[model samples]
Target: MAEDDDIAERRLAFGRAFIGALPHARALGMTLVDLTEGRAVMEMPYDARLIGDPETGVIHGGAVSALMDTCGGAAVMAHAQTPAGTATLDLRIDYMRSATPGRAIRAEAVCYHMTRSVAFVRATATDGEEGRPVASATGAFTVERGR
Candidate 1:
């Protein structure tokens, strides 16, 4: 239906704007690959400037963390119950392994639960590899609605 398509477009635009508005996300070249209610996927391309170690050529952990965090916030913002704004309250990330050199990293986040004032999100980052994730994260975010 036209209404459904309109809503989807609006949400996608919101997700793009949200990522574009963040300086860190811009600097890291994160792309909004997909977005829907309660879910978002983002990608960060591999760049030598973002390498953590010259010897390993692995992407920095901080860049991965930022990608996950931004993806989580986008998921929360896209949730049906979330209206105006969201902010990261807490995020815990576990690095499973270094990202494969020269490979772009993709992160997907789901807003699994939401309360009146908070949202819970889980996310995973992979470096173009199937089954093996570079990192996984869980986060809580403040939610503001009806604004």
Candidate 2:
């Protein structure tokens, strides 16, 4: 039991450090909300500076893309057999609607599959609502071995 607890603590610490080390994540105020094997959730508070259109105050699509990409990377790291590090190989995001001006956005990612060299992830960004996503994404990441 002690060993399990220690492992969990270490994993949480590592996840925190990983998110903290990214400049863009830090700039966007991204927080790791939850993490487990093969899954991760992250949140970014609404900020006026992130609004793409000053008139409408809609959060930029780029911000959503960045959130999903970071969340996907975190999901890959949460996978039980993840490699030393990972890099995005490809990412595609489809925006369904604009994020509400005053609402924080959250992204959830699942690493559904992994190979020796690649990991596949699906992710969604939403304004804390069910079924109404601001955007959805699918991504491939390169799994670096033997760091």
Candidate 3:
């Protein structure tokens, strides 16, 4: 790894140590790909049982939203610069296209602002295709200050 990347690995290691442990996260096959000051990427393998539209074989909108939401909050949490807890304030997901059932979905988040108590984020979910977004989101999350 490059020098900067090595430093980032240490920071992300810290983030992974904090507040990333949730049982449901593992159950849903969520994997944290990277954690930087203002960016994050996560992915999950496609599961047929997660599809709400079984007949259409598309990933569920709700599941898509959850994936987006988690990345958004995780972005803020990773960049929080203080000892604060974080929670989703609002998660708005727009489904641009259906996701392929057999393909894994990846969600990427970018944090534009991290205030004392709120963090602003934007994210996108994709299945490695051109002009096809499984979902996209923009939202803010509350950062609970202090231990």
Candidate 4:
């Protein structure tokens, strides 16, 4: 294989490794869908215990934001082609509709840009119904320098 191809293979491997390193993420009940050069996909299944309002069975907005933030960070790390800590500079999320309990919510995140010190990303979460997004987010991230 060519040198670039070799590096690409290695980066993908590193993405998986970095993901596995976050055990708390596992306890959060999120599943890794995929990671690419400037993107990451994930899924979170609805659980009543994690729901903000048990009566409504709707997942909390804060929980949705956390998922998006994580996705943005993962996207930055994958696209930077380096292992790094990403801090949320700004995050905006819009809740179009409420999430239903027991449904799996899928998130798709893309890093549109990553400069030397920052990364820009957007992600959306949905439970497959078409009219409205369960949640959507856009954020800027600061990539830490050095260890």
Q: 62-138, model 4: which lDDT tens digit per residue?
A: 87787787777888888754546788899999898888777878888898987888888999988877656798999
Q: For all the candidates, what are their Cα RMSDs to the real structure?
A: 1.3, 1.4, 2.1, 2.7
Tens digit of per-residue lDDT, candidate 3, span 1-147:
599888888877866654268666666788788888778888878998788886988878887787787788778877747426778888888888888778989999998888777889999999989668778899999988875
* Model 3 Cα shift for residue 119 (angstroms): 0.7
Misplaced by over 4 Å in model 4 are 1-13, 80-83
Candidate numbers sorted by TM-score from highest down: 1, 2, 3, 4
lDDT of 2 by residue, 6-83 (tens): 877777678989999999999999999888888999999999999999999999999999999999999999898968
Better of 1 and 4 by TM-score: 1
The candidate scoring highest on TM-score is 1
Task: Give the clashing pairs for model 1.
Answer: none
Clash totals for all candidate models = 0, 0, 0, 0
- TM-score attained by model 1: 0.94
Model 2 CA deviation exceeding 4 Å by range: 1-6
Please rank every candidate by lDDT, starting with the best. Answer: 1, 2, 3, 4
Q: What is the lDDT of candidate 3?
A: 0.81
What are the clashing pairs of model 4?
none
